[model samples]
Target: MSAPVSTGVIPELFRGLFDDAAVFPPGNLPVAEAVPAHRVHRTAWYAEAVGPLLCGAGRLGELAAVPPTSGAVGGAQEAGATPLRVGLVLPGGSAELAPALAAAAPFELAGVELATRDAAEAVAELDRLLPPHVPAAVELPRELLRGDGLDAVLDVLVDSPYRAKFRTGGLVAEAFPDEDELAAFLTGCALRGLPYKCTAGLHNAVRHTDPETGFEHHGFLNVLLAARETDRAAAAAVLAERDGEVLAKAARSLTDRQVTVIRNSFTAFGTCSIAEPLGDLAALGLLSSPDPLPQEDR
Candidate 1:
């Protein structure tokens, strides 16, 4: 519930940008291990860049079984550590929402993301069941992006409390959206002023093809830069850019207002490994390595 802790090391553009998705693939870190690791992240030097620990709705019971650790939900707690802040991920759609919320009774619920084919149904279910205080992002099926289906869903979401979520990558190559498709999504959201989040496939900060899988992955920086553009073609070009230095220069040139406008639309993204992205930012000279934390804090 509290804002992410900023140590003045991470820039405004990236604060609370990387949601911890360790329990999801291709990392698939176990819940027991993830809980403690998440606590460590909350206290780390770059805590400002981190977001909630995301757990699937089906695995809330597993997450619940993990014992509490010393860190607070969003940052270090002086009074004593509190329950971990987590975003519940319901891959099974709105059908599992009610039960998921009930199951998530123990943790500090930061938000919820659910995948759904029926946008109307998902919207109605969220209206009927989801808590108003809890933010929700409905993941639109990829097929919707190609048709008027995206507009139909956006129309409903524009007036509602919920936002949009897009899947950037998954286990297979088909899961990653090409530049044009992602461009349309970005432009559409920008046109509507709809906030959205991305999940999977954003392995590093710059756009690059994975050597192992040969899958062309979108860089999170590329997405950020792309989100700033309202023109679909221009946005697509940003998404397709593979030069790390170019991307870093663009990122460094962003004024505070530009950073706010970009982040307002793109929100946060789910990443399996926080270290990888942190390393990428440091390598780009966007983030400086903070001095080691005091031994007591560690």
Candidate 2:
């Protein structure tokens, strides 16, 4: 359902908190199809909660073929009338990055997400590839924590304009990080004052095991609240919370100061379906209206 204009009821901390990832797994919508759907979402009443359409670096040619300023794939606005802001997901140290960025130069480049095994190498590549105006979030293999790579990567990112990212879930069971790993990641980021983003398996607002995949997924609310906390123990407790009511209450309890810190530190997450989270928000009584029209009605 679409949310009404903000009346200061919904926390400002959540505006633009969900980046549309319809082109990704589960959804796997065609780029052309996703583009129009995203344009519609941008104009919806709850549009404030949505961010850029995320596309992979490998699909630069497909993105480039779409008219840069097209209003929507099949809408009233004339083609090339409104430019699309796209987030490019790049493989770790992909040599195609330079060329991909050049290919999509006609549109607004929202940000970049890189997956690398070596944090140090990722940092160096980011320096070489990322434009100052464009922000980047690097995801290092969780296994890197076995050595000093995680520490070294955090050290460099601590002072840089870029941020870090964590994979919250994926297609495989092993893709989900255990509590200890997630706790360490959160603790590390807070300790270093490093802001971060999350991606995958956060379709719902509360942690739950997906019956279809039997993989336990984390809640975006849990992570957001965890980021608000500086104490590692307290944050870990929040991360482990699975009760939606408890999580909702904790979210509502946040003071303006806490909200500011949480939003700044945690930033936005990528979700394949915007509707799922928005629906959850409505169910939790967090939206402007509990029974707003469904997205299709808009």
Judging by lDDT against the true structure, name the best candidate.
1
Global fold similarity of model 1 (TM-score): 0.93
Candidate 2 lDDT over 1-298, as tens digits, reads 1222554434576788899888898778787667777777776667778878888877766765654233343212244454577888886355656877887676677898888776666677778877889988988767775346667778877877788988888888988986666777787788888999889888789888888878988888888888866676787788788899998888888899888888888888999998888888778877665336345311
lDDT of 1 by residue, 72-191 (tens): 433222355576798999989887999998988777888999899887799899989888899989997898768787788888788877889999999899999999999999998999
Estimate candidate 2's RMSD in Å: 3.7
lDDT over C-alpha atoms for residue 118 of model 2 = 62
RMSD of each: 3.6, 3.7
* Model 1 ranges off by over 4 Å: 1-4, 71-80, 292-298
Give candidate 2 misplaced runs (Cα > 4 Å): 1-10, 67-80, 92-94, 146-148, 290-298
